[model samples]
Target: MGRKKTLTCRRWDCEEAPFLGGLCEAHHEEDRLKQLARRAAIDALSTSCIAGKLPEKPGLKDELLRVIRWWDKACLAVNAGRQDNVLLDETQYAPEWCIAFADAIIQEEMNFRQGLDDDATVAFLKKDTWTRFEHLEAGFMSNGVKRPGC
Candidate 1:
């Protein structure tokens, strides 16, 4: 006979019983918000976000910088109605940021697995990940926009 699956939260590392949709209450809400954030990101990136040119030898940093501003804007718009945590992370990380950062890591891993090591992996590890954040924050703050996530 096949083993029945445990009715725990579907999210990683969470053992709490499911509240809805195979996730605990907190995780369910977070999942909902993450979905919204992702949708917003796709919408903005596809239709409205300013397009950036990729260099012939682009690195993870280049890709990140190209869309970081748009990601931040989309996060704010998507998470605005949530009265609780604006940032998926307690350290003020935007959910969109998390998604893109994870993508960068995954791409690097794939590249490494294929025996195609490059500057991209090193770029992903750089300390200047949030280089443009302060500028965006300043503009949003000066305009009295409600920025979420810390």
Candidate 2:
């Protein structure tokens, strides 16, 4: 019988035998940690935006832009053959929804600061806005759109 060839890690400069997905155990762990950090950062930004804790203009705008850019990249990845339908839908429309929600919050913040609304009125407005946003998000999820940190 002929001897079988040994497979090595696919990563450059690594000669260790692959443990999973063509990566050595060390490389796999590194990739996992990196993904965790990326997800954590996304979650933090998303939570801030959803809670309306960001300043009305620049802060909200910045977060919206970041999320939009992320979705754009995700869509590009999908186009490059990622083949996740739910991710594709999310990358297509969730950013737009986020923008709309952020714009509404910014407008409400402006009205609140301009003395057009009392504290109680502003609170109710915020509550209503959040409820609507939640409903919209739930609708997307129900339709099989899985957008994390959205």
Candidate 3:
């Protein structure tokens, strides 16, 4: 009689024997939960996001900068197979849509910062733009904030 080969779990960094669907018990459960939460993972849906040019109001610009930073990083993460971010996953949105939104947001950020004479704003925009999204660095978040999203 020939010896049968042991099948290993096909997930990254998991060498356990296959439990179901070629994944180990833990991975299979994780995938199952992910499949169930897929709908809520997308809070909204749209075929196209215009991301029309940002206006020049201080509050709007400050807020939109945060939004732009988020979408930019999320799109990059999705492209790099790191869809764990809030951006639409590969299964939900098209690559063209992702790239289009990213481009619009980048241009919008530039528009917001291009006219600023302050050196801190310029340096932050050019370099640490990502930092602003989380902690609101280099720019002040205004009060009485009211956007369509909120």
Q: RMSD to native for every prediction?
A: 14.8, 16.0, 17.3
Sort every candidate by lDDT, greatest first: 2, 1, 3
Winner by lDDT: 2
Worst 10 residues of 1 by lDDT: 83-92
Would you give me the overall lDDT of model 2?
A: 0.53
lDDT of each: 0.50, 0.53, 0.45
Residue lDDT tens for model 3, 19-44:
99999999999999766434322211
Q: Which is the better candidate, 1 or 2, if ranked by lDDT? A: 2
Model 1: per-residue Cα lDDT over 71-146, one tens digit each: 5554565667432222222223454454555344344544655678655544654334354344344543312444
- C-alpha lDDT (0 to 100) for residue 31 of candidate 3: 93
> Candidate 2: minimum summed lDDT over ten consecutive residues — where?
43-52
Off by over 4 Å in 2: 1-6, 49-150
User: Each model's TM-score, in the order given?
Assistant: 0.32, 0.32, 0.29
Better of 2 and 3 by TM-score: 2
> Which lDDT tens digits does candidate 2 get at residues 1-150?
433367788776777999998999999999997676455435433554433355454354564455455455545655675633434444455444434444444455566456565346544644554454444446545344444676
Record all residue pairs in model 2 with backbone atoms less than 3 Å apart, i.e. clashing.
none
